[model samples]
Target: MELRLGISTCPNDTFIFMPIIHNFVDTSPFTFRVVLDDVEKLNGFAVKGILDVVKVSYGVVPKVKNKYNILKSGGALGYNCGPVVVSSGIFTVDELKGGKIAIPGENTTAFMIFKYFFGEDFDFIPMRFDKIITAVEEGKADAGILIHEGRFVYSNHGLNLLADLGELWEKKQSAPIPLGAILLTDKLKKEAKLLNNIIKSSIKFSRNNFEIVKPFVYRYTQQLDDDVIKKHIELFVNEYSLDVTPV
Candidate 1:
């Protein structure tokens, strides 16, 4: 069967999925029709039950639990790798209360973390993840919660770090932060193990053949700096991505 697959265009996602999408791995039991979009868009697709398999924020799991099952492979989870809150000027966490903040999406893990840290007291404007830094820099919002490559390059946009949500979570929960996850709908449940292995194989293939997947990563990254792209892949595609361990 050919499954409808959805994933983000981020470097870590592109790097791990390049081999599978390009037929470098043996996708024996199933073939994929892929759709690449921003991670938040993928979450919205999940809510609509539009894809057979997708990468979505873990925060979206509860809302779409009936439509999808969390896959054990192909996720972004780790230490010091969570979302960051940034602003054009210095602001304390206490001062951020009731202030305007730009978040990637209401359904994103980043947004969930922000809520966990600050509660429902802030004015949140949901925008594209790539736009949050600029939104803060331009004073459109008092601050922005950044995910993916935004965390890496926020300083270049002249943004100041307000808090590292990942570090905060780690300190409080003493667990790895769960960012994005691979979710397979119930229709694909029987093939879950097989699909998981295929995803694992794909990530392994990409790591061993980095040069082969580099161009694909670059293509979706909007021509980001080569070093930044490499750093993104290194930071996100780790053991947690290969298998979902307890968080």
Candidate 2:
């Protein structure tokens, strides 16, 4: 038998998963296929039962709860911080009401963030962060919400940051944004132990083999240099949990 795993290639996740994926496959009992897609498509895959295990945004969890289960251990919570909100100029979330905001995808924490802060009533145009910067710069939208490399390159596009969505959540609730997380199918609890072990082992292997995976991260991330790649690895892939966390 086989299982399917879905995920995003963002640096935060990429760094964390690099080691985990390598270790998971090597040490786990179940063999599986891996699907790397943007957060939006990835969420759909698992939600539709097209894939067995996948990564999903924290926000999307409530919407698809009946169909999926949160893996708990590796969730990307705000922990008093998350991706910041940025734009071409000074603006508040309220200012963007009815305006255009560039975002990653419906299943992305960034998109949920935009929705959470803006109250699902605003207009958001989904696109890659890099493209979001260009769209905002060209005055296509009132502002933009960035994720991935966009965090590092916002200034390059002549845009200024307006907020840190994660930080904002921390300030409000004293916890992380509870961003993206690994998920299991609704009845896949049988995977709890295996999934947990695989993630733990993957992280262990990556810590020792970062040099080998650095190129993979860079290649997928628009050829980011070693320094940035190393930093990327450092930022995400925190302690892996093999259990579900409480709400």
Candidate 3:
């Protein structure tokens, strides 16, 4: 049977997952299929048992621990990971006090990151990444927290970057934010070995063949060019990618 795999188009954190996922489908060809969505909806999908495997934030592991397993990946940690806070009026995390902050979704790492620094008292309006920037720009929110491609595109919207969560994590913990992880749900627990092999092989393929696919990555993404996306790919892929870790 073909399994359902979910994808999000976020950059930085998700670069590795793309290649690893491609490898699985390319290698098995007939046994796997993918479902795509913004991370917001994807998290709910993951919770509802809609996907066999999905890319999820490290911060999200704790919330879904009983329902899913956090797959381990190499080179994923110690990498600079964080979302940028943006708004027309709120200039800093400090300015967000008691105001509504637009979050990607409740289960998203972006939402947790905002909550971590802003406290639970702050109100968060859930929106997808595609809509979050606009909501903040149009004054639909006091401010917004953005992740993935938003990191590269927020400035174009005339929104100001209030704070860098990755930078904050590093200063506080003296390590890069444990940004994301590839997840395999308990529903697929019996297929762990098969799944792990496919992911590993795909990661290997992407690293070895990145030059050939540079155009493809660029084509699918915005106008960032191959170099920038390539940098993110290198940062996110490889030894850091994984299939599972102990809680």
Best by TM-score: 1
Candidate 2 per-residue lDDT over residues 52-152, each given as its tens digit: 77888776777778877777565555353366677766667666678777777777777776566657766778876557777888888778777655666
**Alpha-carbon local distance difference test for all models:** 0.90, 0.67, 0.66
Report the lDDT of model 2 for residue 211. 77
Worst 10 residues of 3 by lDDT: 238-247
Q: Which regions of candidate 1 fall more than 4 Å away from where they truly are?
A: none
The residue-by-residue lDDT of candidate 3 on 150-175, one tens digit each, is: 76667888888888877777787776
Error of 3 at 172 (Å): 2.3
Winner by lDDT: 1
Task: Compare candidates 1 and 2 on TM-score and give the better one.
Answer: 1
**Clashing residue pairs in candidate 1, if any?**
none
Q: How many clashes does the backbone of model 3 have? A: 11
Per-residue lDDT over 47-155 for candidate 1, one digit per residue giving the tens place of the 0 to 100 score: 9999999999999999999999988899999998899998887667678888899998999999998888879898999988888877887889999998998888888
**In candidate 2, where is summed lDDT lowest over 10 consecutive residues?**
238-247
TM-score of each: 0.97, 0.86, 0.81
- Model 3 residue 74 distance off true place after TM-score fit, in angstroms: 8.2
Residue 71 CA displacement from its true place in model 3, Å: 1.9
